[model samples]
Structure formats: structure tokens, C-alpha cells
Target: MAALYVLLAMILVVLLSPLLTPFNTSTQFSDAIALPPSWVESGNMNYLFGTDDLGRDMLSRLLIGGLYSLGLPILMVAVSSLIGMSIGALAGIDRTIKYQSLSRLFDTLLSIPSFLMALIIIAILGTGFNNVAFAITLSLIPQFIFVTRNAVHEEWHKDYVTASRLNGCSKAYLLYRVILPNVTPTLVMQLTVSLSVAIMDIAALSFLGLGIQAPTPEWGSMLARSLDEVYLSPWSMVLPGITLFITIMAINIVGDSLRRALKERVNS
Candidate 1:
């Protein structure tokens, strides 16, 4: 719980810091180019994390970049979960030939690595935040579909579901009123895990020049831009890398904790 609180605080900082900070993320101060972290006497305290090659404030960029890095994945997961849950629920309740075919189609999509699928989709859709989010959502939908389908299938056979059927409940009523509620905990857990993967995928695409474009403060693009300045100002690269690492780790910890809690409740 302490870890979760700390993680939430970090997320709030990332999401809100740009608005709170005075520095402009895009404005370049020529004097501050490639400066190391502010702790060094030569560096300016104004730029706490340091300045990039173009003299953009590292801290400011990170905070602004959070809007993209964090925002896109969250949107992607939500859209994916909605589509996945709908299809999965239908398949789980119906068990028809059409649903089975849809399951096989999801399996086929799953066989391809999500990053690879995103690349392929991006190749067709061109590049932008919306396109990237759509691509990531496409890649993620299959996992949610599988998870929700399996969870719903298991819940469908439970004693409560059987009792509901015996009471002359319609399939729609059972699905919406009973099965979905029972399977929701598992779905929530899957959503958390998927969010972490979505972040990594978004970053990878940006690193490959297929995601958010240059001059943007996205962590992946920041890393890409910092490569040439690695010897001169390594902190530029390290800061964004650390930011990404910590954010993902915190999300995973929270997700895992929730999963354990859910399991314990179920067992009890």
C-alpha cells in the first residue's frame, strides 16, 4: 500500500509537473546546451535534471513528455479493453461457430509480436499520436480478448451461473448481470499489465522514429536525440531512461499487488 501511494504520487507529479513548473519545455537557452545535472558547479540549478543538446530543459521536457508517454498507453488500454471485453463476453456467452472463428482470428493476431504488429499498422496508417495509439490498441486487443474470454468461460460454468439459468434468466441477463461482474477483477488485473506493455511499445516505436516525432519531449525520442551527446552529457539520456524504468516498475508492482489481493479474496 505504501508503494502504491508512492507510485500514485510519482504519476501525479509526472502528469502535473509541467503545468506547475516555470520552465518552457520547448524553448532553448543556447547557454545551457548539453549541460550536466545542476548539482555540478558548472550546471545551472534552474535545470535540475540538465539540458539536452538543443538546450531544452530536461525536467520540463520529462514532465511534458509524460503527457504523451503516459497518456497514449492509458488511452490505448482503455479502448482495447472495451473492444476486447465486448467481443470476449459475446464469445464466452454464445459459444457459437462464429464466436469460435473470432477466437481463432484473435489467436492469429496474438501469434505476431505486438511491436511487430504496431509497425505493420503504422506502415499503413502513417505517423501521429492517434495513429500510434490506434496501432498499439490493435496490438493489445487480442490479449484482452483472450484473457476476458477465458475468464468469462470459467465463470459461465460456476454454480451461481447454473442457478441463474435454472431461474429462467436470459443469456443477456446472465452475461451483463452475473458473469461480467464475476470476471471483472481478472479483467482489471489484465488492464494494468497491458498498460505497462503499452508504454514500452509506445517508447520503442518512438525510438525507431515511427512514433512521436522529433522536437517532442517523449522519453523514447529523448533517448534517440541523446545518443549523439552520450559522451558529452550522459545525464540527458540517463534521466529519461530512469524515468521510464521507474514508471513501468511502479505500475507493475501495483498491478501485482492488486492481483494478489484479488486472489486472496477469492480463496477466502
Candidate 2:
């Protein structure tokens, strides 16, 4: 099944991360530079996927780079989702003009393209993982905000929310206890979609040289580096490109399934 393959791939990456990364990929070894894949080399386990022009182990770099690539987006999506959801929930609890004004501003923000917004942020803040996370979070905040605001607004109009308010529940308690739980199914689906988008955006930024720097293992940077020797060792491009593709595909598939399941449950 597709799920089984994805699960297996996920497990393989996590379990093999430590073992797969070469012990000293930084050490220069010109003699081994641009070696073909192991399939082409007899009695050579050193370069499983082969070596780059700098003789860096492709397999090792893939693991370390993948860790960097995946980790940033995961953290960015989580923090942004929490922040956006909180703001949206608070805005929905308002019965006045101020809340509606804030909600409209959030809607305006959602209208901007995330990539352009992130590009501007990166241009202002500079590169590195922290900057990447900041850009990604900012770019995705509107999505979570919109989802949470709408969910809370709908829940606020429901009988249960009115009943809670009648029972002397404070706005804070009502939002946390009554509104949040009801909206969680929706939130999960939103988060999953946001996470996938964040990952793609992070990778795009890195590919454009506005994200993670060189000598630091990252899927996009690796792809960028491979271009020079791509003609000589096509595997240089093939391996890292495949790695990025598979990881993104796996995340997307999982997210799509979650979204479908959540919608079905809500409808039922």
C-alpha cells in the first residue's frame, strides 16, 4: 500500500540518519572526487551514492541535509499555527468592530503570495535556518489565521457556545475549553496542509540561495551544488533530486489523507 511504503521510507530516514551520514564528509579527498555510484564500483562501500566534486559522500550529505531541510519547516509550521490560531480565536470571540477590523487585515495578508512575502522577509532578515523559519512562519500565518477564525466564528454561533456563555463561562475559558476542542479537527487538517507548504517553500528558498548556506547539509543546497558536475556524474543530480521528491511526496500524501478524513468526519 502507499501508506506502507511511505511509513517504511519515513522509518528508514529516521533510523538511518546517524549511520548513513559519513564520519568525515568535510575532509578533502581529491582522489575520490566525482566517483560513480556504488553500483559502478566494485568493493567500495565508502561512496554508497557516490562522491561530489569535493569528494563529499552523497549518502551522508543527503541524511544530514534532509535533517536540516525537514526540521526547519516542521518547527516553523507548528509555531506559526499556534500563533495564528490564538489570534484568530481571540478575534472571533469579539462582538465588536475592532475584531472585524483585525480579521479583515488578516484576510488581506492571506491575499499576498507566500513566496513573494517570504522572499521579502529573507531579503530583509538575511539567510540561515532561523531566518528561514521566520519567513516560513510569517508566510503561513494567514492560512492558519483564516482557518481558525472561520472555525471559531462558526462554533461561536452554535448552541453549545451560547449555552457555555449562559453558564457564566469567561471568554478565555470558553475559547479554550469549548471553541478549541470543537475546532481541533479542522486545525489538524489546516496544520497538515501548512506543513507541506512550509516544507516546499523552505526548499525553494534554499534552492534560490536565499536560505541554507553551503557546507551545511540541505537538500536544496545539495541540488544547487550538483549542477556543476551534473554532466560528468548524472547521479549527483539524480540522487538528491530523488530524495527531495520522495520526502515531499510522502508528506503530501499523508496530508491529503488527513484532510479527507477530517472533512468526512465533520460532514458526518
Candidate 3:
């Protein structure tokens, strides 16, 4: 199911790439600014989703915008998952207060509101794709650590873990060879869920002008820039918003399915 979700998203992005993204992402065709969806405007075949106040194609902007909105989250998720899973696996195998202490530090992080954390980070780092990713990664790492930590803790208690330890397996071998395999399913499920949140968070940051910036074709920033003219060109708002919704919804559906399957497998 997770595979299905990923496949669907990749296929959608690929199919939409040429038709959806801005023809010249950096160039501004001001003459076409604020045009309505082709269906709304007579004799205009271009701008299927309409144009922004700058006459930019809404559909094109949406397409390119999705690249950032989706791209950042996917990157963050991959980085965080690797780090988090490793940390968690080690903590579980070590079974020491140090791991608990490390986990506690992340718990303190979890106490702060995610948007507030991102805002604070942005305030220091300033707005850019890298800054936004850093801010979100900081906010999200704790979840990965916590989930991986707990999953590892449970795996450590399994019979095979004890058998591996007693069989004179090295610490590294026990973690990599024995524990890592057992925890992968849980880790993958967590990644799916975390990826969804990452997507939503970055979009929110872009909406606030603290992420991706203008003229680069990001959904949040596009929506932010378009909100003022929603009445004039509803597609300006609708197109980006719908894309964000669909992407998040698709991620969630996949995450939920993965979670259910993992739970069922564990039970069985």
C-alpha cells in the first residue's frame, strides 16, 4: 500500500510536469496576469487553471510549486529517517540512560509547537529552501527518534535479540544484523506519516513567506501571493490549495494503510 501511494504520487508528478509547470519558471509574462481559468474566460485557450495577478499560469505555478512543496518534505523525511532510525537502533541496543537522556532532549523539543519552532528557526536562518528544511527537520527529528527508540526498545526485548546477544554477536552486528531488520517495518510506517507532516509544514512556511520565496514556483508562496486576488481569479487560490490537499490526502491514505498492515502483521 505504501508502495502504491509512492507510485501514484510519482506518476502524477511526472505526467503533470510538462503541462503543469511554468513554461519559463523565472520569466514573468505580465500581460497574462490574473487571467481566469480558460473555461471562465472566452477565447483564451491558454492558462487552463487561470493566471495569477502577474499573469502567471496558475496551472503552471501549481505544477512547479508542487516540486518544492513535495520535494522538501521528501528530502527531509529521507534524511531524518536515516538519522532517527540509526539513533533509535543504537539506543535500543545500548539500553542505557544515555539513550534515555537523548530521547528526553527530543521530548523537550516535542513540547514546543512545530510552527512556532519553524518560525523561530526561520527568524534566525532567514527564508530559503535550506532554512525551511532545517527548521522542519529539527522539529520532526524528535518523532523519528521517539518512534524508532520505542520500536527498538520493543525489538530489544524479543527472543532473537537475546539470542543474538548471547551468541557473542558484536554490538554493531547485533544492531545491524539482528535488530535493524526487525524494526524496519515500523520505521517505514513512521516515515510515511512523518513525510506527510513535513509536506504540510513546509507548505505552511511557504504560505507565510518564510519558505521557498516568490517567483520560484512553490505552492505555499503562490497561495500567499494569490490570496489577495482570490475574488478576481479564484483559480489562483483553488489550484494550489487543491493540489496541496490532494497530495497530503494521498500521503495520509498511504500512511494509514501502512500502519494498519504493520499492526496486522505484528498481531499475526
Candidate 4:
């Protein structure tokens, strides 16, 4: 619960950061280049977190960067979950040769490392916001597909499902109304975990220069930009790295709690 509250507070800060800070994330203050964190006596309170190599406020950049860093992954996860779940559910219902073949294809994709898969996809599609999201979605879809397919397959074999079928429930009705409901908790847990993976992937891609481009306030790009000045202003890199770490950790904690709660409910 404490983690949840902290996560919510972080999210609110990210959303309202622009309003909270007067510093322009893009504008560089020549006089404040490589400034240490404020409260160090030499640092200006105006740039509380300090300035980067280009004199951009680290706090302002981190807050604004988080908007893109967090937003894209959420969008990617939602899209992948929708498409993967639908396809997985359908394949789970139909054990036809074609569907089985599609399942095998997803398995093949899953065999590849996600980061490598993303890199391959970026190579083909080139780099951009949509492309990066699409790449991450592609990389993540297999997990959702595998989870949903297995869950639905299990639910389909249950006594309740058989009872429903005996009551003249149509295939579609059995899938949507019966199996889907039973599998939803598992799917929700999968989504939470996937969201965390998506966040990491987005940061990785951006760090590799395949994602959100320069001058943009993205956490990964910020980390990449700060590398040259690490010896001078380590906080620039540390701030974004810590932000990513905390956000991912908080999300994983929530995901774990959710999984436990769902498992308890199932046991009950």
C-alpha cells in the first residue's frame, strides 16, 4: 500500500511537473552548466536537481521525460494485450491446423530474445514513436498470446465450461462469457508484468538512439546524453536512472501483490 501511494505520487508529479517547475526543459542556461544539486551551497535552488551538460534543468527534464518514457510503454502494453489476447483466445478455441500453425509461429518468435527481436523489428521498420511502440508490441505479444492461450485452453476443459456447452452455449458465448471471465485475473497479472517489461524496453531502445530522439525529455535519451558528462555532473544520469529504477520497482511490487491477491481469490 505504501508502494502504491508512492507510485501514485510519482505519477502525479510526472503529470504535473511542468506546472510545478519554472525551468524550460529544452532551454540551456550557459551560466549554470554542470551545476551540482541545489543545497550544495554552490547550486541554485531554481534548478534544484542541478543542470546537465547543456545546462537543462535535470528535474524539469526528468519530469517531462517521464511523460514520454511512461506513456509510450503503457500504450504499447495496452495495444499488445488487446491484439494478443484476441488472437490467443481465438486460437485457444480453435485447435485447427491453421491455428496450430499460428501458435507455432508465435512460439518461434518467443524463442528469440525480446531485445534482439526489437532490434530486428527496428531494423526493418526504421525508428520513430509508432515504430518503437510497434516493435515493443511485437516483442511482447508472444507472452500474452502464450499466457492467454494456455489459460483459455485450461478454462475450456473445466467442468463449468462443459456444463455451459451442454446448456447449448454457442462457441462464441462460451469463449466470451465463460472462459474469458475465468482467465481475466491471470491476464491482468500478465498485463502488469508486461507493462514493466515494456517500460524497460522503451528505455533501452531510446538509449540506443532508436527511440525518442534528441532534445526530447525522455529518460533513456537523457541517460544517453548525460554519459559524456558523468564525471562532471553524475546526478544528471543518476536522476533518470533512479527514476526508472523506482518506477519499475514500484510497478513490479504492485504486480506481485496483484498476482498474490488473484491467486488467493482463486484458491478461495
Winning candidate number (TM-score)? 1
Q: Each candidate's TM vs. the true structure?
A: 0.94, 0.87, 0.87, 0.93
How far residue 40's Cα lies from its native spot in candidate 4, in Å, is 2.3
Instruction: Quote the lDDT for 126 in model 4.
Output: 95
- lDDT tens digits, residues 52-153, model 2? 888778778777776677766777888898889887887778867887888788899899988888998999999887888788889898888889888899
lDDT of 1: 0.87
Error of 3 at 153 (Å): 0.8
Error of 3 at 261 (Å): 2.7
Q: Write down the lDDT of every candidate, Cα atoms only.
A: 0.87, 0.80, 0.76, 0.87
- Whole-model lDDT, model 2: 0.80
Backbone clashes (count) for model 3: 4
Off by over 4 Å in 1: none
Better of 1 and 3 by TM-score: 1
**Per-residue lDDT tens digits of candidate 1, residues 1-268?**
7768877877787677767655888899998888888898888888887888888888888888888888778888998999998898888888789998998799789899889999999999999888998899999999988888889889899999999999999999999898876676688789888999999999999998999997878999989888888988899889989989988888888888888787777667
Candidate 4 lDDT for residue 144: 87
Model 4 TM-score, all chains together: 0.93
Clash counts for the predictions, in order: 0, 1, 4, 1
Query: In model 2, what are the clashing residue pairs, if there are any?
Result: 65-217
User: What TM-score does prediction 2 earn?
Assistant: 0.87
Instruction: State the displacement of the C-alpha of residue 252, model 1, in Å, after optimal TM-score superposition.
Output: 0.6
